[model samples]
Target: MSALAIILVGLLLCLAGALSVRLAVLAAGFGVAWTLAVAFDADTGTTLLISLGGAVLAFVLTLLTARLLFFVGGLCVGAVIGAKLFVLVQGGGADLLLLLVMVPAVALTSGLLARRFERPFLVWATAFGGAALVLSGVGRLWADAAGELWRPGTTAGVVVVIVVWVVLAAVGYSVQRRRRD
Candidate 1:
């Protein structure tokens, strides 16, 4: 059921991206990378490490072209979504909430910070992964607080994901506005 939903999302994303050349390229790149990762059985830590490496590559390549933004953004979003899928398959509700919330939040914050502070790749990598670890702990706390957790939607993870996505989407819009300012 959940697998079907995720597949539907991937299809929709591909369809939407196909409407534009730029989006199509992004979607294709993401699909290829995701497929490779899955085929390789890349675990959560490995995926993060690979993404961090890619982020560094993008940062370095940014010296030549400003197009690194696309790579960084793509890598961050892909990693988050991929990690969430892994959690959903391997872990329970607690793991799902931890990855889903922490991954996007960390990725977004780091990407934004990288631009604002001109930070090193190592800094972004460490901060992002460290934040995820902290959030995982917090998820465990919430799991403990909750009397029982069977399905994710009924648990704290669902609430956190909903709230976080709403807040992040708003923040993303505001950031876009400020960038236009």
Candidate 2:
């Protein structure tokens, strides 16, 4: 991916992670709608309409039920993690079934956790989601430097990226926790 694209993706991830509960409805709804529209090869206007409708529906659902919001937020966070993991594992020749399994497993686990832990869950989920995005962006940048898109670079480089991701996530988590307190 281009540097600009990487940056934009990173920023988006950070935003989603930081405000997951607030944005979950719109993100999940529009994301699913867009995916369906593209899968069906819908026209531009149709896609827009579908996405907007989905967003509105999601907003109403989430606004009406706090529990649903938590579940959806967790699902969205898990989906992000699942996608990142899928890409990493796919590079190792993982099967389609594995990808499918990973997504629901992560989503279910996260949803349950969110239900059980409430605010703490949101904080951690957002932190981890943001970290994953940051890691992916850095990885892409490294690959670009090496004339590739997703190539895993040296072990040292990988370690550095992971360390940075963890630190940033910890900071985010702390900040969110403090805000809640």
Candidate 3:
């Protein structure tokens, strides 16, 4: 039940995150709380209370530290860009020294870019993050319910999941971009 709730909340984020920053934060909190609640095997009442608590926490935190969150989000975006760049560089048989140089450089560049374009950055960030969250919740729920065999129950399941995530992310990105404009 809680797992399903997480999935629903994640879906909301994936589809409409950029419509409202507060909604994105609250949805993230709702998904996280429900995901945790699934482990507790609690009654519906307790789960609802926990989810509400999570939302309240999200509200308070966002109210208190919106700017900090934006900065941190920029840093996080930088980290992801750096990681991807690292992999691309590694493909050329790059060495440790190059990695040490490249990652921070890319990260710094990305952070600067994010700082200059906060809304667009948030849209992309929320889209991908929401898709990932949805995938996680679905995977967890599927595994717990089916025992052993995951999502699609076959190797093709992996491909399917990846494709689905990409599509979701893309759609979310488009929707958020439109909304932002």
Candidate number of the best lDDT: 2
Q: 1-181, model 3: which lDDT tens digit per residue?
A: 7767867876776677545668778898988898788788978989888988898898899978866666666565455445533543353465798788876776566556556776677677657656766776676688765322123444455556557767888998988777767
Clashes of each: 0, 0, 0
TM-score of each: 0.30, 0.61, 0.47
Reference-based lDDT, residue 60, model 3? 90
TM-score winner between 1 and 3, please give it.
3
For residues 1-181, write the lDDT of model 2, one tens digit per residue.
5755855665555544545555766889998888899899999999999998888888788768877667777888878767765665555565789889998888888888877786668678767776677666656666656322233445554455556657877876877666656
Error of 1 at 37 (Å): 41
- Worst 10-residue stretch by lDDT in candidate 2? 146-155
Candidate 2, residue 21: lDDT? 51
Per-residue alpha-carbon lDDT of model 1 for 23-54, expressed as tens digits?
Answer: 34445555555556667999977765665555
Off by over 4 Å in 2: 1-20, 23-64, 146-161
Please give the TM-score that candidate 3 achieves against the real structure.
0.47
Task: Please rank every candidate by lDDT, starting with the best.
Answer: 2, 3, 1
Worst 10-residue stretch by lDDT in candidate 1?
12-21
